[model samples]
Target: MRNLLVFCVLFSFIFFNSCGEPSKKKEENQLEEISENDNQEKSESGVILFFGNSLTAGMGLDPNEAFPAVIQQKIDSLGLPYEVVNAGLSGETTAAGKNRISWVLSQDVSVFVLELGANDGLRGVPLEETRKNLQEIINTVREKNPDTKIILAGMQIPPNMGQEYTSEFRNIFPELAEKNDVHLISFLLEDVAGNPELNQGDGIHPTAEGQKILAKNVWEVLGPVISE
Candidate 1:
């Protein structure tokens, strides 16, 4: 009878231990999955905010086909992990971009590509106002994110707008870039600005091929800052 009780007790011990092993393993697996997810979130590279208007919206082209997208592809191909946020709103002026600058800067961005002033120039907005708004945007970004890199993409007004006004608008970007000690991506439309073949029918937006070149133009300046 004592031997029989001993045998029963041993059987119960073995059964409970066997049952507890799988449960412990399941908890460990759950903990591992949570840990992996947290690690991935922490490993993600910083954000790139492209703030501008239709030229930025890639009007007449797919959003994913925009120059920003091209830059993203280049970054990926080079195996640099980063996120590109297209904050382009069609027909948005520098004033409008300024209005939203605070909200946009709320994101944890590593870089900013300021591509406004085009719509302001197109609409004949006062060059001083454009300069002021852009300067404020730059100053705000710098103040909020001291380490964020900025690339000022320049824009030119059409000749019909009179050379004085045109030159003032064009010079805003470089001047601000210099004042802030940031990089300047001269002429967002470098290869595609005046070329009919490169521009879409609107003569403002770029063709698909043109967008690719524009992306490269911005990348030339941006790549270096981000690469480092």
Candidate 2:
């Protein structure tokens, strides 16, 4: 009888241990599944890169106050899966932008917004040079990924440089947009450009209010493209 009781106890212990092992293994498998799903979601998120000068950078304002950040807010509201990257640098000419295009293209870009040439125009760079650099940048982006959508932000400098030069500068954007078949943001600073209230004291960078308009302008073009 004592031996029989011992046998029964050993059987119970083995049964419980086997049951517990499967439960623990099931829990670990569930955790691994959750981890894989999280990684898949992150990898699926697309990147929208806004590459340009201080206008894109929001030079004088808080980083979040930049137009790209504002656009991010809009995107979140719409439940979009794309991420916005502000690659704007202060005083970035088309040449500087060309130099860094490769580095910036390191990340997979679903959409590429080009906002350079403003600094170049302001500084009186030759139109041909500006056009060539812009084309090269566009080419680099295409070479990296032909699927990337390109948007050219049209910029206009005051006629401080003769009207002929200013007109040609303005024309360059449309021409590039046409030649490369990229979308164009007619003017990055439409309603805010000459508005004293919208711009900062420098009359160049937009104030917070000005940034709102810029965001609106971009959305006009961006909304349609993304929707497609």
Candidate 3:
């Protein structure tokens, strides 16, 4: 009787363990299928690759209210059809952006907006390094597709960084734009930067209204590209 009870317990344990595999496998398969479906949806719609840091990530605001979202809304309202593929990773530096350039450009991108380098500025990384990373990304994308519309969103360092350093950082954008002959938005947060109402508590990221202004800023530069 003791032997039989031990045998039964062992059998139950083995049976339950074996049975769990199918359930686990089923869940994994379902998740994979869902992911594939989402990818298909994104690909079919059309793609706008947005590579940047927190500003592009829509930090402190809903995804729908982010600059990308605002751009999508404008696209929709104007009957300009395209998908906004937001690849903005908050806290990413230009080096990180450089690392991911190939992968982002590999996609079916109608337009590419490069909004990185802010974190690099904030961290006081070498301006040359920031410029090189951005330049490499721009060059690589152009190599992949010569006609690809590239928008370089410029950023300004805080005044506390000292006028000399800040001036050098500020000049990076126009210098690159002039060299590359690509479209430039000048400053990503032009009208809202110092405005307390347009920015969040951090005074860095934009509020919802600020995002609208930003989207408008980008559109003023990017609108003609898509329109043409």
Best prediction by TM-score: 2
lDDT of 2: 0.91
Q: Please give the CA lDDT of all the candidate structures.
A: 0.85, 0.91, 0.84
Off by over 4 Å in 3: 1-46
Per lDDT, the best of the predicted structures is: 2
Model 1, stretches more than 4 Å misplaced?
1-20, 24-43
Scored against the true structure, residue 112 in model 3 reaches a CA lDDT of: 88
Instruction: List the candidates' TM-scores in order.
Output: 0.86, 0.89, 0.79
Candidate 3 overall Cα lDDT vs. reference? 0.84
Cα lDDT of model 2 by residue, 149-220, tens digit:
999999888999999999999999999999999999999989998899999999889999999899999999
- What is the per-residue lDDT of model 1 for residues 13-95, given as tens digits with 9 covering 90 to 100? 56767887435454455556666766786568789999988878899999988899888899889888788999988989889
RMSD of 3: 11.7
Better of 1 and 2 by lDDT: 2
lDDT tens digits, residues 52-126, model 3? 988888998888888998898888887666878788888999999898889877776778898988898888899
Q: List the residue pairs that clash in candidate 1.
A: none
Give the per-residue Cα lDDT of candidate 1 at 52: 89
